[model samples]
Target: MASWQEIEREFAEFAAKVRARFDAGTNKTIATVRRDGAPRISGTELKFEGGEVTFGMMDGSMKLLDVRRDPRIAVHSPTLEPPADDPGSWPGDAKLAGAAVEVEESPDSPVPGAGYFRIDVTEVSLTYLGVPADHLVIESWDAAKGYRRRVRK
Candidate 1:
């Protein structure tokens, strides 16, 4: 797994694009494993600070409990449709997959039992569709493989 800092250091340009997409909106989506091993989706807010991706959850929240029991997580940037007049202008969608590690809460934590987690990214990807006329593009980065690009019609 790699930290956000490591991803930025190795794939600076791509990382920037991904970060921009993630920051384009206030709410993001996170996927976690439920106790029955089924997938659970939750709305979340993300913080990219101090070269780390962090998030908080209310105490005893199901999502928080899920992460506590199983740290694996996948976070998706908010989805935005491309304008009809400017298909290529869309920022595309970004995804980050990793394991969450519980971290100590700051003194200013809003909730008494709020849980904080730092994401240790294992994979990051951006996907663009219909950007270059009937083509789809995907760019991905990983700790072991660095960066890769793929295209489809």
Candidate 2:
């Protein structure tokens, strides 16, 4: 498990690009595992605080409860349709997958008693159209392998 800052330190440019994509829009998506071992997707927003990738869930919210029972989760940054006229201009979208660690009323908690957690990020990725707007490019970073890139036609 690595903090967002660790990624930034190791891959500053890639981290900045991912952060910019996340900040460019709102209503990121979250994926959590239900008690039944099923998958759940929900709308959420993220807060980048003190090098932690964090977010909040309303008390008793299903998503919150899901994470409480199973901390494994994945988050996707807000996405946009690439301009048809200039696909090359697309900045790409970001995604992070990891375990959600409860803060337990930490000082950084935005609201008292609210369910807040930071991602112990296991992986982070960015996907976009490549140069010449021909192939698709995927960049990924993980705890074990560090960073990797692949191009798809």
Candidate 3:
């Protein structure tokens, strides 16, 4: 098993991979749960700066509303490979969950629903070709920065 620090490093590396694959385009998806218990999922651009994941939304978007009402989210990265209709030969996918908070918008940015929502990721699970791995439970989170490795009991 990897130590907490090593796991953090792996997460950072994985973030870099995601950024390279999606940050420049529109491929990432954001899923938020509403206070009324509805689930809202939509594609959004993901930006990583100084190790924090930032995603933007229009002020009036349902996702934004959902996050505001219930600031919990699950972000998913679908299998990169083309999905096979058959259950076999499928690629892996990744998902992370955490608490979310609204971020102040940039004064100069003109994107309409340009406000950001930052998620303080608390749990992460990686599925390799549909095999679920052990869940990583976050011991602590920092929205201003990121997460610190938790000491193993």
Best by lDDT: 1
Minimal lDDT window, size 10, model 3: 130-139
Per residue, candidate 2 scores C-alpha lDDT tens digits across 1-153 of: 799999999999989888988998879999999889999999999988789998888887999899989999999999898998888998889999999999766565566557988999999999999988999999999999999999999
Evaluate all candidate structures by whole-model CA lDDT and list the values in order: 0.91, 0.90, 0.58
Clashes of 1: 0
Better of 1 and 3 by lDDT: 1
Q: What is the lDDT for 135 in model 2?
A: 94
Tens digit of per-residue lDDT, candidate 3, span 55-118? 7788788887888788888777643663456433433455666777677785546576656766
- TM-score per candidate, in order? 0.94, 0.94, 0.61
**Lowest lDDT 10-residue stretch of candidate 2:** 104-113
Off by over 4 Å in 2: 106-112
Per-residue lDDT of 63-128 in model 1, one digit per residue for the tens? 999999999999999989987997877768999999999889955576788899899999999988
